[model samples]
Target: MQAPQREEIHLNVPSYKKNRSGIAKFVVLPELIKSLLSLAHGNADVECGFSENAALITDDRSSLSDISINGLRATKDAVKFYGQGKVHKVPICKGLLDNVKEAHSRYQVDQEITQRILEKKEAIVAAAKLTKHKELVLVGKEQNLIGQRKILQEDLENVSKMLNEGNSRLEATVATKNFAGVEMAQLLIGGAKKKLDVLKTQLGDNSDQMNQLKKN
Candidate 1:
């Protein structure tokens, strides 16, 4: 049935609704009504497609079959592609219309699968780069530690030589049997020993760490 015209809705005169003239439609002819019912019944299946689409946009989401969703996307693509004159660029399958929408639908599914594969490949490459960056950072830390360890060892060796020289000088002073010289040499030797002990402790810790690093 046709709806009210725009002018009819704008009319606010008292006579329109008072005379029951606002309601324009009443009895539909029998054959016309029958034909309308038949058309509505036949169009039910088409309208049901909107129900599926409605679910996609609504809070009560529903899952459609893969084939159905693919075909739907392909249909949208088909319209745009045909408008741009690119639909014929594709190799039309034999008896495409006869086989329903399978011709374009299978292509859409394949394209989707290919896109997913490309995305996965990109993810893998990104992960690999991250792992490599972590490894590089670890290597830099190890190199810094090794350099610090070598410096500590060299300091320890230099302190050992200085301590040995002090001990030798102390012995020479003692050989002279001079009390003042002995006291001075002993003080120097004591200071040398203290420095030597600290160096030895540092070297010991560094050696242990180097050993562990080697094992790893």
Candidate 2:
């Protein structure tokens, strides 16, 4: 049977309804016409190609990538259509020879691009890791400095208390007219004052270090 052209069907379909009493009277004919019109003509070659593509992907060849599968399909189709179903029967053209010669160069360029992208990713990751490490080090330093400051403040307070106690004892000794007790009290006060000065200086140095860490 011969199929009608799309233009002929488009012009003649409305006539079927006009000739009949109503659309319901010509229901099956309209449906048949619609089905025939909807079919994509000249698609047999494409459908055949899809079937051939599916046949190529066996269990052993399931890992083939889209590019590899496409290349294989093209080669097979070329062999069957142009080469008369044999690889050696294919004609050696200048274009084919040129593409063959340039394949290595193209592959090398692709490799360089891929390697550069990978290296850039690695460098970014390394930089992030270094920054994190530095941040952790700064945190540790800050905590250490804070702890040292606390210890220093405590020592300064204890030394100040000792100095005050020594001065009170010296006053008591002097009031009692005891020369030896006053001399001992003066030595104790001097030692406590020196320790208080050292603790103050250490605390100041710790504060400076903490400030520097913050700036970094």
Candidate 3:
């Protein structure tokens, strides 16, 4: 009247009932059970170390050598655990505790010295960057002065050409004996020549100043 019974398996009892899935319904993962059972105190240890490590290895510490940093961190963790009464976790023996203590003290001193060296290196790098910035500013100023000098020289040449053209035209007009409009033409030409001369003088002075700046 009843089907043959499958073997019953029990959680931690080695005998329990199985569901249709063929797994022991009363059985559970041992590790999961242990973890759940340990929650009797309803407290958990948050691994703050992951976040601390993330913060510590910021942009500045990202460049640290992996091997050297790993060694330092390992030693630091051992010291912290030992100080926190977790000495059993650390591979330290009571017989050599004195030697380990002395070594830890020396490690602390070396860490302080390393910290100072890093600070000095940062200061030196900052100073070099400041000097480089000053040099760049000076170079930009020189380039600007040179460009102004070039512009002034070009302007002087243009004014000189205009002055020469005015003089040549006046001479041609005189040769033609154009008496009717000669006076007005001469006035206009003279005015233009005067303005051109003034401009030429200014440009020439600017050119000289530019050359002086170049020498300096």
Give the number of the best model, judged by lDDT.
Answer: 2
RMSD of each: 15.3, 8.1, 12.2
Question: Candidate 1 residues 81-198, lDDT tens each?
Answer: 6555366564466675656667578768878997999999999999999999977876776787789878877877776777777777778877877656766667777877898788
Worst 10 residues of 3 by lDDT: 6-15
lDDT digits (tens) for residues 23-49 of candidate 3: 865456554555655564532334555
> Would you list the rank order by TM-score, best first?
2, 1, 3
* Model 1 stretches with alpha carbons more than 4 Å out: 1-95, 98-100, 103-108, 212-216
Structural similarity to truth (TM-score) of each candidate: 0.47, 0.62, 0.42
Give lDDT tens digits, candidate 2, residues 51-81.
Answer: 9878999889989778678878878878889
lDDT of each: 0.68, 0.85, 0.67
Clashing pairs in 3: 8-16, 9-15, 9-16, 10-15, 10-16
The candidate with the higher TM-score, 2 or 3, is 2
- lDDT of candidate model 1 versus the reference: 0.68
List candidate 2 segments past 4 Å from native.
Answer: 1-94
- The model with the greater TM-score, 1 or 2, is 2
